[model samples]
Target: MITTAMRTRASIVPLLLALGCPQDGGTASEGGPGTSDGTSAGTDTTVPTTSAGTSSSGPDDPTGDTGDTGDTGEPPGEPSGNDLDQNALFTCRDQPALPPADLRLLDRYEWTRNVGSWLSSDLANNPLYPRPEHRYSTYSDDEALDPSVLGLYLDSVGGAADSWTIGKWDGGRLRTVHEDPECQCFLYDAAPTSECVRYFVRRYLEFGALFRPASEAQFDALLAFTEGVLAGAPDVESRPAVIKRLGAAAWMSTGALHRPELGAGEPDEHGRLQLGDWELANAIAYALTRTPAGVPSVNRSYNAGFSKGDVDGDLGSILDAARDGTIKDPEVVAKLVEEHIGGIDEARLDLLFEPHDERYWETHSEYWMAHGVREFFREWLDYGELAAQTPKVEVAATSAWSGYAVENSYQNQIVGFYGYESTLDYQLDDMIARILDTDQDVFANLLTSRMFYTPATAGYQENETSIWKSTAEANRVYNVSGITPQTREGRWIELPQNERAGVLTHPAWLGAHALSFENDPNLVHRGKWIREELLCQNVPDLPITVDAKLSEASKSQSARQRMSEQIDADPYCAGCHALMNPLGYPFEIYNHAGFVRVEDHGGPPDGTSNLVGMPSPELDGPVTSAIDFSQRLANSRYAKRCFMRQTFRYFAGREETMHDACTMVAIEKAYDDSGGSFTEMLIALFNSDSFQTRVPD
Candidate 1:
């Protein structure tokens, strides 16, 4: 069957690809043409690239000859196909392994996204999800569940279940579900003649609860409850009884609230407990993305329409097909790598194109990259406080925005959130995706590439629009070295140089890491993020007795001047501050307001920066600016391994430990072998024993 998604995409594919991928007006391939079998799917998904990640020169190639492959040693015009192999200079070594932890319990973000998939619709568009508090981190669910959080989940889940059954209770839905079901909602609604509701409930419980259907015991118990609900019903049409039963299961059931993947049976030949289909599905989705199982892969939005014919509901279909060997003999173990984990389709590749406000794509392209990292950058960079970003702090002599405070919430908004957007957030996020998706040397593209998107009028002196944050007050000054603004409200891609190379200079990272009125960038925080997140090294937490604060006397000097003098004066604070201050001072190129500047209110900016404490022989030591640091970082083996290490912790939801050493080595190898494909690194992790094995209950 041409899936509903495929049918819809058949017509719009050309338009979407043309907008972003200049090389993809023709039928394209996914993850390039180098599949395990080395055969192409021949789907109109991506512009096929050579094994080295360069666009293929074919009759349909829309992006013409990429100039010269000459010396100067850049990977031709395609520029490393996302610059995947940027770390070719570093010597490969066995790196420290990542630790795997029991990934139990649904994080709040996962819970909400999964709920929408089970029901096969975007409930957020209907204004159904209740946000008790803003979510900054995916791990917030690891903490003790709050009463308000539980309440929010209960209400939203119930609403979703009710919405599905209510919309489908009429004739043909039951047949539509059983003949060829879409998601669990249709599967539940397919129950014929109330007598078989128990059998269907068992199936859904297995699917939605994140548990195995080892016995009929749980199904029998739930059936008893359904019989009780039906007993209160009037006569023949006991549909209300079924809906109520499904709703209850969707909320109160174990799988509904927790990620319970109990150990099942004998150890595989590898000694890892073989996870069941449901467990595998849940884990795979959690590792790669938090989007609901059945959600479309791209152009998704709150207002995006929901159709009943879609088959992307849960992991059951893919896993079941693999086991039965129905289509091609799928090693389900490797299926996790090839299809879901490693592979890319046209939908995702299309997200690279900015819509220009005319195409009305359903979702943004960058969500794929964001979801891949277990650590959400919004929380990591502290941009979750986007709502609090205001015009209160006037940037010094920074054009019209110097005194005018504009807080444009329409930055780059993700689709499912209740009508929110931000260009600065999206700009950085899209850059991350472009890097990970395009090439090897993934870190090279991630750190050193200077491309970014921004409003055409970001630097314009005049503005009129007003919304959550006054657009006029919020119109950002385009002060980065490499970018040039293209439109008033839309984003255009621009590549910058020097300190503009990586996310360190992106507005989202800069804005989130800065102080409100301190105006000077927080060197300590910036340095800390680099040391921990990027370099994968831990600086000891400060002592409780020690309060490292800038004295009033010190505050008058420029941030650099004050910081340098203060650190020099205090022997105790100097130890940790040394790790962060020097590394962070490079970003003094931009103010805490996220606009570029040569100096701060305090002192002249220090143009020189360094990769302090980096253990890599090639990457460590002095650098000139953020751009220089980004280039060195991309070239560092230590930094690249740490990045992959971060990728593992994010998906596995654990810290790196000795137990995970061997598997982490496999991941490191994949990064090197795949020429820096971030997708390859993820595939290696998912396919490893650490991701598949669980601790026995």
Candidate 2:
């Protein structure tokens, strides 16, 4: 009998098949990079090798590392990356049955991110836009199962290639041995200069997008589907049309694109598969840069399996000589920081690509053609979620006419405060850059840093004021330029340490978590971000049956008064609300604009709440304000461990499970031992058993 989980995936295949293949009737197929020729689009058919149970000894796969090449029914011992002894770690170290060997589909972000990597274009055109973010708060264990994403994923895949050009980014050269210039849409032909376009597209779907191989049967089905796409194109022979068809088909195809493993080696006696070295390389690459930078070169075998070779020509290709053995994990992270994240050393100049003024700082951050974790965090934090198209709502007018702009208050006032100049997001980008550069106690520094960048706005640029560090004092005792009466602009202004904290007090975060009409702090939201994004905790959704309403009748009372009446009264509400509300109340000292406030204008301010449930034994207690809370958070063991959990999720591309406990503990130990360095934490995760182990269904 099929299990419920098995049945769920079984149902998805037919639904995707029903979306139907490309429409017929067009110019005949022609040879292209990584493809073959045919008289008609649908007539040409080929069967690629299956992902499993295959031997690899191709020219490209000379090493033939058997790591991820084919299935070895025999169980391999636990993979590496585990620093702790299993017998001493936990009783459940020997997991009998690994997760089912279901295929893992890309969520919307990964889909766009992967394809964008292939094309060498920074693709902002994502189908997953304007949906619930696959974030820590909404994350569920079922998410790893490919079947869950089928319905929402279909439309995204179908139209994704609208802007794609096989040869656009890499100057149209489909180089296999080396990507002097590469193209996701461009396939490889046997000739050095020509394209085996069809063949290459299928392989890319497996290696680039799916991060796995496909079987002969799977390729036949995918080819049939691609041929169907040609049925509808007005001109099938159009090279662009064909290229788009291949990318879209592979992207949308459910079965091949979604193959997942517990991390991949043979099953253990308890039936466990360790994630292979191949996948470990991938996990490290994607987490740091948010692309398939770590994937090894494939053999020409039918399944096109793996060997230990670097990705030919992309951002990570820079590490070709060092990735395999020379560099330790910390060095790997160091290289990524220097090359991929370049914004930290400068201030952002929105209109000009390069800075004209000399006194301010290095204001040039854009690299001609590149994508990285900076891009990933842009989506990860949903910083521009309010600015997305399709869900067109008037944001400027919503604060008065209606409180219904999609992200008006959140985006416009906070992240995009200075119109198109997203100073806040850039600030965040800088923070990540700095964290990676220093790579020590990253979580604590992020929470406690007093450094911030203030742009050289019109006032300073126009000579109305000086853009110097001394000019930008954050304390209320002094002020500066007319535009920024509280603080001036330019460089990394080190504020008075006691008066400021990290991003929690940042205007972007504060504004994002506040209201439009009342312009008050949304403690629940502010607190939730900390719990979910930082601590990796989930405050369960309010029960649907209950209205879960907020009361606002205290006209004479302050913002907290209105919320306290409703949220604190219901025992059912307290179950979840308590986790968030406690931390949120501390931020009442700041307004939506992120300016300091000693008093509330309306009534007495109650900026006090119990800081409880942190994993640390002594850190849980009453905190006086957001300042105190942030400082305590920087010191808490729970917060640091939680930071690792987020790292695992970011790199692993899945939420951490109870089964991941030993891995998490080991990573946390590395963090502790390494003086809480983010670099070491990353090393710990990539070098662990979980990083290299795969679990079969």
Query: Could you estimate the TM-score for every candidate?
Result: 0.69, 0.63
Off by over 4 Å in 1: 1-103, 117-160, 168-192, 199-214, 235-242, 268-272, 291-392, 395-421, 456-469, 472-477, 480-490, 518-521, 602-604, 610-613
Model 2 lDDT tens row, 388-443: 32222222221112232223323332333222223454555555555556767867
Worst 10 residues of 2 by lDDT: 20-29
For candidate 1, the 10 contiguous residues with the lowest summed lDDT are 31-40
Counted clashes in each candidate structure:
38, 61
Tens digits of per-residue lDDT for model 1 on 652-673? 6544344455666778887788
Task: Give candidate 2's whole-model lDDT.
Answer: 0.45
Candidate 2's clash total is 61
lDDT of 2 at 665: 73
**Considering every candidate listed, which one attains the maximal lDDT?**
1
